[model samples]
Target chain A: MEAPDSNIAIAAAGWHFLCERAEILVLRVSREGAILHANRHAVELTGIPLEGEPLEHIFLGFADGPVGRRLLDRTGETHLANIRTANGLPETLYFTALPAGDEMVLFGQTDAQEQVRLRKEVLALNHEMGNLSRELTQKNAELAWLNAQKTQFLGMATHDLRKPAGLILSYAEMLEEEASGTLREDHLHLLDTIRASAERMKRVIEDFLDVAMIESGKLNLDMGVAAIEELVKSPLLLVSKSASRRGVVVTTDLAPAGQRLRVDGQKLEQVITNLLSNAVEQSPDGATVQVGSRRHGDGIRFFVTDAGKGFSEEVRGRLFTAFAGTGGQKRDGERSIGLGLAISRRIVEAHGGTMMAESPPGKGATVGFILPAQCLAPMRSDEQNGGVR
Target chain B: MSEQPGSDPRVDSVYDRYLASLLEGERTECTSVVEGLRAGEVPLRSLYVDLFQRALYQVGDLWEQNRVSVATEHLATAITERMVALVEPGVFGGEARRRVIVVACVADEYHQLGGRMAADLFELHGWRAYFLGANTPHSSLLDLIEKTKPDLVGLSLSIYFNLPSLLAALDAVRAAHPDLPIIVGGQAFRWGGEESLRRYEGVTLVKTVDDLERIATGHGSP
Candidate 1:
């Protein structure tokens, strides 16, 4: 071998140093396609040692072939390759190969123009997303405002109609009392129909008021301590009267009979009233409606079971939705307004409780609510002695 | 620019950390920093102007001075965009006033974060803000105005080179809705364009989020 010139050697060393520090990737591979050396940039970019590895390992989308040899054959032509980077993402790089002595040298650089195009596309997509998001936000605001307006209108209309409904109910009751003995049989039956219609109307109006208040986010509660047994028994008085008229028996099984909890006494009584009424309305003639309360998982669970045709899965799903009309017919063929259960559930939820309904096929249905332990207020002497004030 | 009211001094360090993470493309770290500030109850306006806006400006400056590569600046911008979106849920809360404003970037103006932040500020002040994102065409903008019947329109301009496009958009809006109010602002106004904006009537140049807030709440004119 001839001795290399010192000046040529020095220039070669300087070029080697430049290649090592270059921002682009530089690699020297053997003829067989195994990497002989990788520059600093190449190692740093890939975050792996490159010596003695096949050059194809760094590039993606190569078939089972000698990729390095083919690239070496195309000496000065640029080939686009996606180089796997350290960050677990592929980066597209343009590469050129050159024959050097008994090996091939590769240089890789990022395609700036391609990057610019990609950046533009990404920015456009991002802008589209942002515009859609803005539209959605605006639409949501409009819908909320419209809903508020509807709720306000509902509240006002219900408030105004409630007065007329009460007047009709009062007049019907007064006429029923004053003309019970003097009227003819048919006349008395007509008077009874009028009273029944007025009572139904009053119930429907009251349910509407409850729904309106709940929808307007104004379901205020006047919280007080009450015994669970008293709460259960108070509504039974009103419910038993209607149940007996249908030949349905009303019963109660309050286990923790003396259990006292903090709740809105009036609202809790309304919930019991709603549940018992619904049970009585759905019960078959001579069937029984049972009300029960017991300790359940650090809470008190109250449930009403009725011997009526069970609800299907579909009806059970929306049983507590207002105006869902899942409420069955009474013995007199009078339909319920379907807002009682919904309002009852809302009242229970306001007291930090949850409502549920279970109906087995060919069996009866049971609707229940559980008030959390947070509602279990210590019984004051006055509340205990005065029977749940 | 004056510091925004409710700006916390603690956010200065958070801004530095966020800018560093953004420039390095560490998205998770940036998210953590932003979430931390939000959890600490740093006011939304301060998060926008003090942290996000200030860091982006610094990143732009770094690119101008050649201290950072253009790719790094763009990475910072992309991260900041995500961070801004992270703050959006907090932006749309509170009761909405019955006013509506349509915000858009002028044609060929792609830097839209500032305008987006401004729209969010309006939302915070209870005005329903509809943001039409970057490079919005004049015709489409006019069509939206016709459809939405907005009470006000806002145009954003980022680069000074887009001043002509902004002016064209302004003229299109003015010709269509003669009595409609308009507000214009962005980094482009920092260099110039405010004087040119004076040619149109009922067009105000809002310079800060506070100014936008005052205008949105009907307390001050822009």
Candidate 2:
């Protein structure tokens, strides 16, 4: 245990520090493939006796080929190999060999267990995701099927309900006309209520069906060229009774008297009727509801202005939605399903037109829609510029 | 082949044709479009969403802008309603599950289309669906519920202003039959968002037909 020579001790200490601090498998082999030197880890990993065993003999258990020949023939070659431990357990290692004087020096690191586990997890996750995606596709198909069923059912309901409601209204009207003089005022009132109720029900059914049909892409329009007088007078005539009932004076102002529009007369009438009805309903007993139509730009602009409580900013924001007029009640105390304006806007837009509402608070409100000079496109072969040509 | 007006998927072209046909009062062409779509294997759901919904929305936009008249709008709607008959056979073919489902709009709520759609969805799920259209009297609705003893009840409120009526309907139903499952839908719920659904416990807010299917199937109840 006496202290070795200072030079020898220093060299020995340096060799030991280099081997342990490398943190990599370090091996030295002779030109003949004999094991010349090995670090602690290399020896432990390969389980070969240091400085004596032939590298070929040590790697015989796991190397794919003669490792000694492969390493000797190829300098600075990097490769992966399964090297066996003392107990014959296999651990994968990657290494690169470089010429070190007359011998070959190999440096490597064993593939860690964490990396292996992570790789397995990734593969499993990919498989799981595949299954999930397939399941999602299947669920979407099922959902689509259910949706189709729902649409169909709605169409059927609307159809079935509409006939009965229409029949009820028609019958009520017939009974009223047939028994007009014989019926008492109270009886007439009851009949009127029944008729009104049936009419309202019919409208509701029709609106429901219309929305369904439009949503299903089944709505169709008949386009025609009509005089501005007809467009203004038609809807006015429809709303005249309602206007007179509320004691609201009805007036009309049409500019450029003979100006005609190439439009859908029926749809345009509905739009006018809705605006006029709304206007008449909002007007006070003696207030006037004015209907006007004019040639504006390349289109006909029709408006119904009523001296009634104007729309608040909040109500205006949602005026075109399905539930229009829901934010506030009209002056007539009448409630709306809010579908009229929504439906009207869609009709005008379908005709390549626009609809709007304007009001100066306490100055009454003006509701109107515009019909372009021409429908943007001919909807069908038979409708190809039927009159516009 | 030239694309049919309502058959264009990119936009409202197909709906345009349909709307035009209705505007022209061409019943045969309108009916043909629906028949052709079905024969071509166009999914009914797509017809509803793409063709019908898009066209109707466009029609609404046009009418709102004063581009079309109320008469034309009504005609277009009327034609679309008739076209539903073309697909009626396929929609009402499911086996009856013996479960009654009642759908209705609240009192003073005149928008009954959403409820009608819900009722149909329930019926499609094999439930016996009863659609009490807009403004069902509270007493009658209660009586109908009692007589029918529906397994589920669906209520639709299209306008948010009708939330009070919805609440009233809910209270009436809940008082009459505690623990009954209720599902609510419509633009109102969507406009109000999730925070609105929180006002009532045990009432589920469903946005789409698919969501309604899930509820009817009992996979996603409130």
All candidates: DockQ: 0.30, 0.01
Residue pairs of candidate 1 with colliding backbone atoms = none
Model 2 residue B124 CA deviation in Å: 23
TM-score of chain A of each: 0.77, 0.57
Q: Over 4 Å off in model 2, which ranges?
A: A1-151, A180-185, A324-334, A373-389, B1-222
Q: Write the per-residue lDDT of candidate 1 for residues B149-188, one digit (tens) a residue.
A: 9999999988999999999998999998989999998888
How would you encode candidate 1's per-residue C-alpha lDDT over A1-389 as one tens digit per residue? 44679778987887687577668888998877889999998998999999989898897656746555667778999987787899889987888998889988898998778879998898788778866766676566667778777778878887998888888878878978997888899988888888888888878878877888999889999988788887877898988788887799988898675778889999999999988888887788899999998888888899999998878999988999987777667667877668888999899999999998999877798998999988876556645587432
Which candidate should be chosen as best, given lDDT against the real structure?
A: 1
Cα distance off (Å), candidate 1, residue A216: 5.6
Q: B31-67 in candidate 2: lDDT tens per residue?
A: 8777877887776655655555455556656877999
Distance (Å) between predicted and true CA of A98, model 2? 40
